[model samples]
Target: MPRISRSEAEQNQADRAGPEFLEALARGLRVIQSFDRDRRQLSLSDVAKQVDLPRASVRRTLHTLVQLGFAETDGKLFRLTPRVLTLAGAYLLSNPIASILQPAIDRLSAEINASCSTAVLDGDDVVMIVHASPSRILPLSAQVGFRIPAFASSLGRVLLADLDDAGLDAFLARIQPHKLTEQTIVDKKQLWQAILKARADGYSLADQEVEVGFRSISVALKRLDGRTIAALNIGIHTERGTPEMMRQTFLPKLRSLASELQQQLI
Candidate 1:
């Protein structure tokens, strides 16, 4: 018999897993998530490095993704195909929230001449569920379905602020935050304070923590029932304004857009 691979051994052990736990399915999704805005294409080794799986396991996953029409490869490198959008499209089409906000989001981004987006907190990350950018795309431009760390932006802070004390504490305990930029907040105490301040002020502003020369301000989007369901934010280049200028000039515009959405999102 040939030597079985490390991931193969792991998969074989899935037979012992709980009835509801689908180990193979979980690993498949992790392999898919390893491709993102920063990593559009990857080799077998690159994927193994990302998902921390054996190359043999990564190879199997990649070929499976290819057969499913979710990904494609040119012998050496693999990239997700447009067919992958079908997965995201299903959510966008089914979720009334995404559809309700997209047109307004586009208008807001155009009005601000910047990128505007909405996000919801999921685990340790904030997923950008809807987005629009009127200006040229930058290295940091986010689109629909972008998942960024919850601690990295104003948009995330608003969502985090909506959490109760127990929920916030639970999030803090599990997250292993790292610096995304020089200004990124890696300290737990500071992150806690930022979230508290967002709760008190009804908004949060982050300056260049997610990317250099970028700033964002966010306000929570409350439904008619007064639940803070998501957050709305606008991305601006630092040259566009100082922090104070962002407050004086752009914050109200962002808030106004949120207010209009609140009326219909009920």
Candidate 2:
């Protein structure tokens, strides 16, 4: 057995993407996404390995990003600059839901004294589009762009419950879930059942799934025409509330927030 170089692996991926694929643009975007919260600054080789591209290709992309002010290098490792935020800002500026929902979510967070957020599914992950927290420090370092695995998150399961049978099957097939915590559900059939339960109950409460002692509950945000477009969620530690308390106390508030947002969305 032979080990293929990173360049070969990337090229293979590009080849399967069809002739219309701009490998350079794909490579550049992959390079940008490779730098995340945990891997904020990476050397050229590190990024190359992460994105499965050649060091030379990654180097060129990094240099282009630096010249364009999207990234900066300390002569050893490359890190994304604040300008990269403009990319996300552009999306937020175009999407009025974030603005329409932020203030209300802020008020809701203050009222509940908890972290509240709304997220929409993107690919295999759920991306938070709006978030608010109490003035004090937060237990989870989540923001507007924070992402979590769909199978293990309360918000993600609520959003997933909106999918029809075929769509849900497709999503389940695409995901290769691993247990994040002892309580996380990694089996596809069980995950499907969980999403179905959320649909039946109109809400979800996930206990100690993503992190130890953390609990998150969510409700689906539907449009006037009954399309579930997003999920509204509140995250807390188990010390603050048990699963039953969360369902009894937090679920109604989350539902009210979602209802308010739905009225404004259309």
The parts of candidate 1 lying over 4 Å away from their true place are: 1-18, 54-56, 137-139
lDDT string for model 2 (41-127, tens) is 999999989987666778889999999999999999999999998999999999888888889989989998998888999999999
Looking at model 2, which ten-residue stretch has the lowest summed lDDT? 1-10
What's model 1's TM-score?
Answer: 0.87
In candidate 2, clashing pairs total: 0
Which stretches in model 2 have alpha-carbon errors above 4 Å?
1-21
* TM-score for each candidate, following the candidate numbering: 0.87, 0.91
Best by lDDT: 2
lDDT of 1 by residue, 23-137 (tens): 6677789999999878999999999999887778778889999999999999999999999889889988999999999999888777767888889888788888898886574
Q: List the global CA lDDT of all models.
A: 0.86, 0.88
